[model samples]
Target: MLPINIIGYRRIQNRVKSLIKGPLIRKVLVLVSGTVLAQGIQILASPLLTRLYNPTEFGYLSVYISILGMVSVVASLRYDTAITLPKDDKLAANLLVLSLIIAAMMSFLMGAGWYAVGDKLVGYLHAEGLKGYLWLMPLSLFGLGLYQTLSFWALRRKDYKALARTRISQSVGQLAIQTGVGFLQYGQIGLLLGDVFSRMGGGGGLAVQLWKKDLQLLKTVTWKKLAQTAYEYRGFPLIASSSAFINSAGLQIVPLMMVLMYGPEVSGWLLLSQRVIGAPMDLVGQSVGQVYIGEGSPYILEKPRSLMELFYSMAKKLFAWGVIPTAVLAVSAPWLFHFVFGGDWREAGTYVQVLAVTYLLKLVIVPLANTLTMLEKLKWQWFWDIGRFILVVSGLELAYQLRFSALQAVVVYSACLSIGYVSLFVLSAAALKRHVSRSENELSKALMPDPE
Candidate 1:
């Protein structure tokens, strides 16, 4: 048993090390580096934030983030997905300009909507002071949109080091602001201020990098051409962005609904689950998607077979890496939460344990979903998401009608959502294979020797 274990360890170690020798591995490493640091900061700050603020405070913070998160997608007009697909960087710049124009237009529209409906929006969430800081919504949307664009650019340039630095700076800045606010008894102000400071760090850094890169060549872009270019790959990004908004920001609607049905304290508990379960996701998932999409696109174009094989291999790697950590959190969450966050968050452990399944499963499928964007299979991806949306919405509604416990409802709700995510993985991989086969056939035709 000892010899077998040692051999297994050496084999796994060799495979993992070999992964880093490829260019894609470098991007993945850089992206992972950023996520690691950012996650470290979040881990450091989470205890303080939890202790300093109650579930109600977190609930409010979640709502603000949800609103801003949804609006930021609208602000980008889906150009964030286009940065890597196009062969020409100049064309990509035009896509950026187009995203900015849409962002500006949407900002005006959102600001107007807030002015007219601000009270009701806050009232719906059952929170006060939302109207007072309503102005921050639009400003934060701009910041988020610009930051996303810049991040995409860094991805396209394969500037993962810069990207990682920016992410760390932003995380540190946010933690500082929020921690300071906690000390001053500023309540939700801390959360909001932390967000603002982080975006300033991230977006400002991107702006400086963009200017220095001398991408001024983009200035020559024509609006008409850019619009047409945007139209070409528009379906995936546009639908994908909408689905992300719905699924992501849509989580807030659950807490809001729970609060309306059960009360604020229940809502707070649900929010706590989110923070705990969301930790691994924020720490690693986002970074993996960033690098996988950025680096995978070019690989698919140049060496389709190698990319497909790597995709499967990496999926296994991600699963192996995530499983043990997920299991430990699952087993230890209740005790950890009770000790670190007190009775108010004692249930957080259960939440973490329940949701850890989703994260571990996600490690298997999420990277493969990038194939949808790589192959321009937007319509297929959209269908997958819409199906998931229906399942999730339906499951949640049924859970409520049945008067399920908050814990049961969340677990079931997430299980339903995970189904859709897994479905997308299967569909995206199939689509990529079909595309690769067709490309090979075309190449074969072009290269066949002309025999008499």
Candidate 2:
């Protein structure tokens, strides 16, 4: 006979195993495991990185990353997102090619624009240190674009394992280069190079896999098909891309504004805080989101109630998983920063404390925001993005004008953004409800007897 506690433990373990045995949960586990390993590498390296480099250097690196993000988000004109929508693999292949072509063109245009006016722009932004590194932007944009397109292609194919491998490759490549360069005393440029390397690293592996598995599909791609698909999915570029760019800008602009209002050192503190808090949150959200899209897409129109259940279930899981971490950070961020990252970073922890709730809200909402895309609600998404961008920018500007300190400014920013995210959740839920109602109505009509 077993003791009561021992039997209960065994039962709980069995239940856990059974829960994770589902295909959706299993796929999420694979991506989450990869994300944990990859982000863990960077997270573990942060203390060393903090000691190796100073706040100002990290600040410059943050600015570069912000620029890279703003461009990379729209590099494929968001056609990559549409890659998963088509029923035909051949159509998806054409979207993949179209994305690549758009990326290349965007890269060339960005490089040309930089060459024409990079100097003045750097000077105006008070980012002179970034001038030498701006040349890498176009290259990084192209790599990021390539990786995103391939990632969506893999998502469409339900190739979660391949996607997981690419993440590991990116982390390893980034950590190696960044650490080596830091040891060599390359300053912020090392961080910049490492970031660029990260953008490019996983792309080759994804590209190789794509080529080997879909060479026949690739061969079928043609100019006519590309053009036709481009027209077919024009809303992605015109609306979704615009919305994505605005959202990206809203995110990246914070550090840029920090740099402008304070200095690189101040921005550096914010950057570290974001890196520590935001990165893990984003990776987890994104991992869950990838699985949600792959798992939930088929049920969107056919069984919207199933999709709604999945959405609510994912949101609940994310919220529950987020609570402990958010509380820990809210309570202990300052001490944690001082102890782990040295005294210089205690301020960064303050920023984390102020923004902890915002990050938690973001963790829950961002993953499910894909609901908008899945439902073809691009216009609604666009409106929300614009409004969020306005709220963030105006709120920050108000804080600055009122002579609020950096921490206070972050508080205002966080509060405003939290409101925005709450609105977003409501919007998404309403969209899902509307979808469910319509689905139910259609089913009822179909089941009704003919008047004749």
lDDT of 2 by residue, 1-452 (tens): 99999999999999999999989889878977887988888898999999888888888888777877888878998999999999999999999999999999999999999999987876776778888778988888888998999999999989999999989889888888888999999887878888778878788889999888999989999999999999999988887776678878988888888787777887899899877889887877887788789989999978899999999999999999999999999999999999999998899999899999999999999999899889999788888988888998899889889999888888998899999999999999999999999999999999999999
Tens-digit lDDT track of model 1 for 1-452: 57998999999999888888788878777878887878778876787788887877776676677667656766777777677767788888877777767776777788899899987878876766455887777767777877887788888888898898999999999988898989889787888888877886798898788888846767778978876877786885656677766656545456656655554566666666666566656556766776677767777767888778877877888888888988898899888888887778877687777778787777668766877877877678667755775787788778879999877887887698678667777897788788779889988998999999
Question: Which residue pairs in candidate 2 collide?
Answer: none
Listed in order, each prediction's TM-score against the native is 0.76, 0.84
Best candidate (score: TM-score): 2
Give the top-scoring candidate (lDDT). Answer: 2
